[model samples]
Target: MTTTSVNQDKPLPGKPGVAPTFRWAILTLSLSMLLPALSTSIVNVALPSMAEGFSASFQQVQWIVLAYLLAISILIVGVGRLGDIAGRRRLLLAGIAVFTAATFLSGVAPTLWLLIAARAAQGLGAASMMALSMAFVAETVPPSRIGRAMGLLGTMSAVGTALGPSLGGVLIAGFGWRAIFFVTAPLGLLTFVLARRYLPADGPTQKVGRLGFDYVGMLLLALTLGAYLLAVTLEHGVFGTLSLALLLAAVVGLGLFVLVERRATSPLVRLANFRVPVLSAGLAMSAVVSTVMMTTLVVGPFHLSRALGVQTALIGLVMSAGPVVAALTGVPAGRMVDRLGAQRVVFVGLIGMVVGSISMSLVPVSFGIAGYVTSLVVITASYALFQTANNTTVMTGIRADQRGVISGMLNLSRNLGLLTGASVMGAVFAFASGATDITTAASADVATGTRWAFAVAAALITVALGVAVGSRNRSSSDRHD
Candidate 1:
């Protein structure tokens, strides 16, 4: 290995500075975090409008959201690894540039397919952003204040998500749906400018001899997830046969990926980390929580419009409550985790989710929009608590060297869970209603399916509760040792 001089003109990693430029650098990185988080849910409220504009089916329109998520899901780990090998600042800047360009392309897309392609491009940029932002934070902040910094970052993410739908709806109503994409472009450009001016260049520059990128593992992982998600969307006949084949291919591909990772000199995901109980449990809870949260996002708007006859604009307003609660509660949850413990906070949050899910399930047709909104608020608040605690726990337990991989896997698990939730929940809704479109006679049937979905969500949260309890018990024993 060859050694290179560390840049003395730049701020040292983990050093505190009172300079205004350093503060601005942190703000730029934080905003970069905020944009992609916001983008995830912003398009969701506009799905119906997009469908009508393109003369597409509900399933086809869903690709606009799914494609971005799928792209991010597969690419985040690879991007994170690259950031480690290259430079975090370089990746962050490049990501911002690409994301800004993709946003413009999405705005100008004339067809649904083009829009989906643009979204996938946007996701590639997002992967770069998401992978590097956390690494930047860990690098910039002192160890003593890392928790506080992470809490603020988590809060910013929650606020961004909370604002997304409402902001999208307002833009769509005032100007046009395309403005939603356009709004992000300027923000991305500004984030890039700030990052370049303020962030120090501090990433790996020395070439580690014979270090290999896990190209095969990346390819197989993408195929596996893409195929499995496709299978969930298929209805019947030859399409079903193809879906089954894809599912099988995905399973085989995943098996190959594991073997490749095991043999690789530098693996994308370090399998050995699973031996740590905190890492394993925290990651598992993260997956389940992500699945539940995303399913609600997917189902909530449709439920509002089709079942309750709420206006599209108003639906965003109602949906905003959950993320708002999440944002508001995030800092407090972080503080609680720091003061009490991650396990106790997580256990309480999961229990809250169980209650919230049950409340949502009990909502009746006679209760109307007020009732629906109330139930949604509870569910959203519970989710916020769970997410804040889970994220803090996962990031806090890992070593600095492992943070990139852990963050990448943490995000991957969340997205995979979301993809699974959307497909399975959509399939369940279709089965219960016996129709793709929910209207008139199908309204009651749709509600039945939604209630069942909530019930299943409740059960999943209950399982999380058990896991949380067991984790707390283990932590106590470890402390005694």
Candidate 2:
């Protein structure tokens, strides 16, 4: 396989390589990243109010998030393939439009089902943008600056993640739960308009050739993910009858997807890409990184509020520390990755995570907030280093044309990790607490649960570190290295 780098020197806008308007392109992509990132965490604050307003159960309220995640997981690859066929810019514009519309619908939705459906639509739009934004970053930036550009993506996401809960709380308190969705509609619209005005056209330099898409592969892929996520998210444990059936469906669908791809003229995914050690290693480590990250994100709030007896506002502030540190560290971390290489940066990150997770696990009730905050900062900083560097590695690992699919696969890994974290951590928490209903658990019980969860997260991070070390010697042979 052959590959070419975009020119380092600036070129005319709308032409290939680094365009003069590339800064605005980055701004556009940042907004795209922010919107989706904010959407993921923001709505949780409004779930209770939404349940009250709609007269729905807590389980039904969860579907608001579940629906969005499921849609993204299911459709990301197909939309990504569509981008490679139709054009990244075109798909991006369409996605912004769809997301904006869905946001509007969500704000005005009268019924729970309608709201869930709209969230699903929002997820579809988010998937398109998520898959294409990194590809656009790669196409529009020089190879030397790619790490910095990727850092900006991480920065925007960190900012969004940091602000989401506070913003959601404000909206829910001042207006209603509807305002959570309504408030972001303008960002989506602005992104769409700016993209239309400033984003470069898909010129001949990166023009994709064939239009044929593998429908069978796409269907099988969707079935596999949809079933798997459904199984994971459902009330049943992994061994339960319904979960077992769905897992079985996922297995069969995956097998069929592989078989279909072997025969398809224009396959949705390049099956051979999996053989690349760097990409595979990066993806695997990424899943572990996300799982450990989400464990803290999921369990920390309850631990703060219940175990540490922190106030609601203060809990938000303490939680915000993680993303704040992440935002500040991202750019510098990117520069380090560029200078020393992703393997080295990733090792530093894994070490931080291991230490941070261990520290958090050992935090006794007697420990002050300062200790907790320090641990959070270290853990978030680790992700800042790992995420930006690993993303740079994986995106650059593939041929330029394959970025769309690879990005989708990357996001899929992230979502899967998050789902795993939510389920596994919740189960662990319940077990440690000695009750399924942790909401009313004693402070000591909550503390025990939180410690156990962090311990498990630490173990997971250690495993990921081992994998990264094993792959370190193989990095040089990987195509993009």
Candidate 3:
């Protein structure tokens, strides 16, 4: 690459001796992250209310969440590529606009399907926002300041998570389910205005060609992701014929996507990103950690509601503990990453996850709420540690040019993990409890399922631990050699 090409990837330097643009830029990007992070947690409590409002089945109501995940996972890479070709600032502004509009649509959606569609659009917008924010922040801030900025972003995520369930409960109780969506509308608008006012404007983008983007590869990639998610959503312990067909379609679509990428002059995702040891290993660990974290997150409330006959209000209260602890831990974890390096910090985090998961798996029916809540705190704290360290590792390892798509890949691993956790844990729970309908099953059965699910979570976390340790050892060996 020429000097010009390399320089284009770097952030525009703040004017010397004037107001610090880096601080303002980090603030803008952090606020951008807050919206999507808030949205993810806030919507869960309102699902029941939404189901009641729309007179939808439990299974149908799940699409509200699944659709959002599917949309984000499928389009993130394509959108990130667009941001690379276009400008990150411009794409971020567009994302805010779309997200704000979609939030309004979600608030006013009359039918279940309409709400699902709106959520999907919202997810697309959220994807764009998330995919670029880290890259934008990292590029804008100086290398020395990167750790502090990442810590701040981690704090913002924790704040969003900490606030979500509590705020959702209040909104749902006071106004109705729609209020949950309505509250975020103004947040989106505020983010948009602040980002526009504060973010640095993009310079001229270098033109590639008449067909700058690999449209064929983009389409195939979308199909591949969409088909795989659909197959998971339709799974019935064992895959049904429809699920099997979808899975096969996903496999074929992936093959086609690879072929198209090889032929394309400008591909959506570069195969070379995976060659970076830290990037690849960090992403892999992220997926596994997310799988473990999300499995417990999904199953914990179920266990509480069923086994202990805990009320929804109490469950929400109990659920807030993890995020609150995570929020508190975020900055400290980032500092640790800065001091101890990502490998060592991530290793400790994975150990926490393993311990938490093992404790959860062993929780007896007689175990009180305190035990569950303690387990939650441990797992979430571990998440804070792992996420901050691993994210820093991935971002720092890649080139400035690769940051956009690497950000997308990071988020994609997470969403994929969430989907995997939900599906795998659900299937395991069902099989262990011998219940066809896991949701409305007997309390004893549900408790049994929760135990089995946490065992799986523990196993996943152990794998993450191995990955962390192996990477650390490899790096040390290389250094020694």
Candidate 4:
């Protein structure tokens, strides 16, 4: 198979010489991806323990997760662009090193504030990994094997995400909450060593016109997202006035970011790309998919453990089924995308998700274990299909020069979706429970909240389906033209 150079001016870093070790390189890089992905969910099970240990409020405990997500969402696109310019391998290695150090700090954090700070640092590292890992796979693997490689990567990511909670629960149950961070330290170190030894060095230097970092635009974008996230965090609190103010600030900041990007020499997001219906719809669908799936992930365990009196480990096992199916289905989904085009595959997947959400919503509080597992399997399969197809659509629609930027935006869309979904689900759960403590009314509140959340998510998926249909028709028209 011939390997085409995406950038002919510079020799590709991982050429045929590097091909022999390609599999190992992919494996090591995947470990870097897995660590961050796992950390996102693993910490959730430990939140209660963390709160008690530090005498922190629920809001404070939430920041531990939110801070990391917000950082990743805002910075991923910018950093991914940098990786394309500077070298993916360099950024990936640096990210791993920083993430490893942050994990250690989090493990020994004396206060909740420190842990939150560590998490934010960790997120920056995660952004680097998430942005470059795909680009590396695209660059290193031959076209004939790209689909399979992507499928495997997607599967690993799914498994990592699904395993986090159960693994964390077991670790916390046996050792302590700190073990959650400690456990990944060695893995991170090993990955770093392998990356340094096997990963090729290649940073392409292209003379991009008026190339300069858009510092002001980046700051505004960060502030905008930060304010919006802060407002969401204050949803059920006495700080409504502050929340409103922050939300307003976020809107203003976002407007300024758009204006700045329009005039800036080097913008973080390429505004012109959205002109393509496929790109626009694909991103929108990706966001909706994240919101829906994350809501299920966040609320499912709470409902299972509190409402049904299931243990955390057992809940994790049940929840794992969805991602497990998703992991297994990703390759087939990618293959289908290759053969059938992303639009049809994504539409079908969205429909499946709608079906899954409806099924989950209808599940009774007393649903048997088998029924619960069935619901999870359907949800997972739907998500896997949707995600793989959506990724193919967005990535393949753009020019090679823009892949890093678009990929970063894609990651941002996903992280933002998860952040928004978790917040919305939390608010719904809080509202449903009234003023009662979560522990006392765990079952009823969780079940009611989860049902409502799933229903809302289903409604969102319906909107995404409409968008997908429109995109498909538009693509057909373009082809005819």
**Top candidate (lDDT):** 2
Model 2: CA > 4 A from native: 1-20, 204-210, 236-239, 476-481
Candidate order by decreasing lDDT: 2, 3, 4, 1
lDDT of 2 by residue, 357-443 (tens): 999999777886888888888999999999988999889847756888888888788888888777777778778777567788888
Q: Write the per-residue lDDT of candidate 3 for residues 79-143, one digit (tens) a residue.
A: 87788778778899999999999999999988899999999999999999989988786767655
Q: Name the regions of candidate 1 deviating beyond 4 angstroms.
A: 1-22, 45-62, 109-114, 173-175, 233-239, 302-313, 363-367, 429-437, 442-444, 473-481
- Model 4 RMSD, rounded to 1 decimal: 4.2
What alpha-carbon RMSD in Å does predicted model 3 have with respect to the real structure? 4.9
In angstroms, the error of model 3 at 132 is: 0.6
> Predictions ranked by TM-score, top down?
2, 3, 4, 1
Better by lDDT, candidate 3 or 1: 3
TM-score quality measure for candidate 1: 0.86
Misplaced by over 4 Å in model 3 are 1-21, 208-211, 236-238, 436-444, 473-481
Over the stretch 111-157, how does candidate 1's per-residue lDDT look in tens digits?
A: 99999999999999998887777777666655444444555667778
Model 4, 202-222: lDDT tens digits are 655654333676678778888
TM-score of each: 0.86, 0.92, 0.90, 0.87
lDDT at residue 166 of model 3 (Cα atoms): 79
- Superior by TM-score: candidate 2 or candidate 3: 2
lDDT by candidate, in order shown: 0.75, 0.84, 0.80, 0.77
Whole-model alpha-carbon lDDT for candidate 3: 0.80
